[model samples]
Target chain A: MVDRIPILKMGKYLLLSIQVDMHDQLALDLQEDLTEQIVRHRAKGVLIDISSLEIVDSFIGRMLSHIANVSRILDAKVIVVGMQPAVAITLVELGLSLEGIATALNIEKGMRWLENSVNEDEIAGEPESDEDTDAPSETGN
Target chain B: MTKTQTLPLKQETDIVIIRQRVRKAAEEARLGLVSQTKIVTAASEIARNALIYGGGGQCLIELANRDGRAAVRLVIADQGPGIADIERALVDGYTSGSGLGLGLSGSRRLVDEFDLKSQPGAGTTVELWKWK
Candidate 1:
């Protein structure tokens, strides 16, 4: 069996810390696994820690973007955190800006961002003032 | 000049090996963190192109000197169907395969020197040099 990266579940979020130097197949497997996990748990957000990766080539870069897009379709947001400075420089020089994927400096900050975004989403989804005014009048009666 | 080591580019794992070897050589040559990362990333890109587009091949890694500066050189060759339009292949985002098409062009940008040689049905060879 091909080795798989473990995904941790934290409340409404899923976390993946890629500690190994992943081969192409391994990366693809992670992509498949993460998406399935998102749907299974109905995760609201995902945090991918890539600080251990020394490099991010085009293939892996595309895989990250693919995961982000796929998770978005599943109603989950994906955030990549802990990218080393050298890897960041190399990735940009390699002509991949990794556009459309959110990034954070560390896992702590990533979780905060995820939590804040989820909260905002909840606030935006709440019933408007018309419903709130009705609730106050009903309580008075 | 150090001895050249050749590794097969037959599978995905081989690409990872190439990256590690290239990074070691780069560090030995005293390349800074970013330069080492660049060469390693470039090596990975070309190596994958060889395995995927070239149907698997071989890579030659060596340490050399250019103008009295130490450098890491890589020659990746494949015997698959060669590219007819080298210029088009070098263009950004022009991949004939399932990739993002940045492997060839982007790798060129990461190294100090880049060379490509290929002919239709004759195979492809890419030489990259990064100086320290």
Candidate 2:
């Protein structure tokens, strides 16, 4: 049986910590499952902890972007936390800044970032327009 | 000195195996954390290219010492339709597939040395080297 990355629900946020080297199919599955979980739980933010991930290839990179984009469409913000310095350098070298996605140094910081974003969204009043304003321009049709 | 191991790139599972083998080889070469991550990431990109774009081929991982410096080398070759423009293919954000077009250019940036050779209707071969 293919192992599934566990997604935990904490308050209004969903937490996913990737501890394994993800294959392409698994990445796709996570994308599908995470989006579904977001809708079911009506999560306001997602914190993906990748501290254990040794490498982030283009496929996984794209998957992360896809997840962020999809989550945005569903009215959720995504914060990718715990990315290794090495991985970050490699991604930059690979020409992937993981643009338009929020990031933090660790899970603690990630949680704080999510809290701030949720609060900011609440204060913004018109959540729909504010989120639309932050959508990655290239992905907007 | 040089030691080499070859793996077939026939399916998705093969890509996983390739990454594991590359990680082991990098360890044997005593590459640091970032270097190891870079080489492994590069290897994954090219191996996937071999399977998806090249229609499956083979990968060779080698540990070598040049000019008294140690390094790991990867050679992923495919016998597929072949690329018409090697230059264009290496450009960032230039993909013939659904990918973000960062594989070739990004992999190139990850290693210490890189080379690519392709002939239309024949095959494509990518050589990557990372110094320890």
Candidate 3:
């Protein structure tokens, strides 16, 4: 029902901003859009800013973890930033960890970090660009 | 925006429209992405609880004040069996139903403010708040 979830483009990267009133469907939609964007743009990395968000359930935390997995497949790194203290605690209780994913102070900091990483490394360790991260390869999604 | 209001109960499908409306409000207000995500996450969980547990309820999203600062107050209320045991339900891995049981307790961890009220078959009401 969210007519359209806004897609904010930051250079080759995309900023997916979502404000959902319900917790379940919102998580589903976000997961869908993020996966599509990762492939559509072949983005180098993704930053999911959750500052204004009010709640995050186990499903979302799991979805985010899944996003990181697929992102790695698409050759992109994902950083979840601006997590509210409460959301942080919930994820902790659920024992949800971002693993190798990075989190920044805020969206601005996230962008700055990515920019610097790209500039300094000359895009070193570029993740092999694959349009579909969900597709089952000889490996996995 | 400062008014304290209670919304009418609706269904899970209604959440999609609510999500879009909230997202639009956030964008127009220039809350940025971080704010948007946080809002969406909390809203979705609370709304779903109302539909699933409350036997259908209303969603209330208001611009309220917490200690005199701008804040987002979200509430999903249902007149279903109120939570009989709040403490037990809060414990991680404690589930009375077949679901993961993270819906209430897990969501409690997801938002800045979480409040729940349940009294047997009477009903249940939950309140969650997140600020800039």
What lDDT tens digits, residue by residue, belong to model 3 across residues A97-126?
A: 656768887889998887776555455643
Task: State residue B10's C-alpha deviation in candidate 1, in Å.
Answer: 0.7
Per-residue lDDT of model 2, residues A1-141, tens digit only: 356889999999999999988878888999999999999998999999999999999999889999999999988999999999999988888888888888999999999999998889888774543344655548647
- Please write out the lDDT profile of model 2 over residues B28-64, one tens digit for every residue: 8999989999999999999998888999999999998
Regions of model 3 farther than 4 Å from truth: A9-12, A19-26, A54-63, A84-101, A115-141, B1-6, B13-47, B58-88, B95-100, B106-132
DockQ, each predicted model: 0.80, 0.75, 0.23
Q: DockQ for the candidate 2 complex?
A: 0.75
Least lDDT summed over 10 consecutive residues: which range in candidate 1 chain A?
A: A128-137
B21-114, model 1: which lDDT tens digit per residue? Answer: 9988998888899999999999999999999989999999998888999889999999999999999999999999889999999999999999
- Residue A83, candidate 3: Cα error in Å is 3.6
Minimal lDDT window, size 10, model 2 chain A: A128-137
**At residue B4, what lDDT does model 3 achieve?**
49
Q: What is model 1's C-alpha RMSD?
A: 6.3
User: How many Å off is the CA of B7 in candidate 3?
Assistant: 2.9
Q: Name the docking class for model 1.
A: medium
**Each candidate: fraction of true contacts kept?**
0.98, 0.82, 0.38
Q: Specify the highest-TM-score model's number.
A: 1
Give the distance in Å from residue B122's predicted Cα in candidate 3 to where it truly belongs.
7.9
First chain TM-score, candidate 2: 0.87
Q: After superposition, how far is residue B14 of candidate 3 from its true place, in Å?
A: 6.5
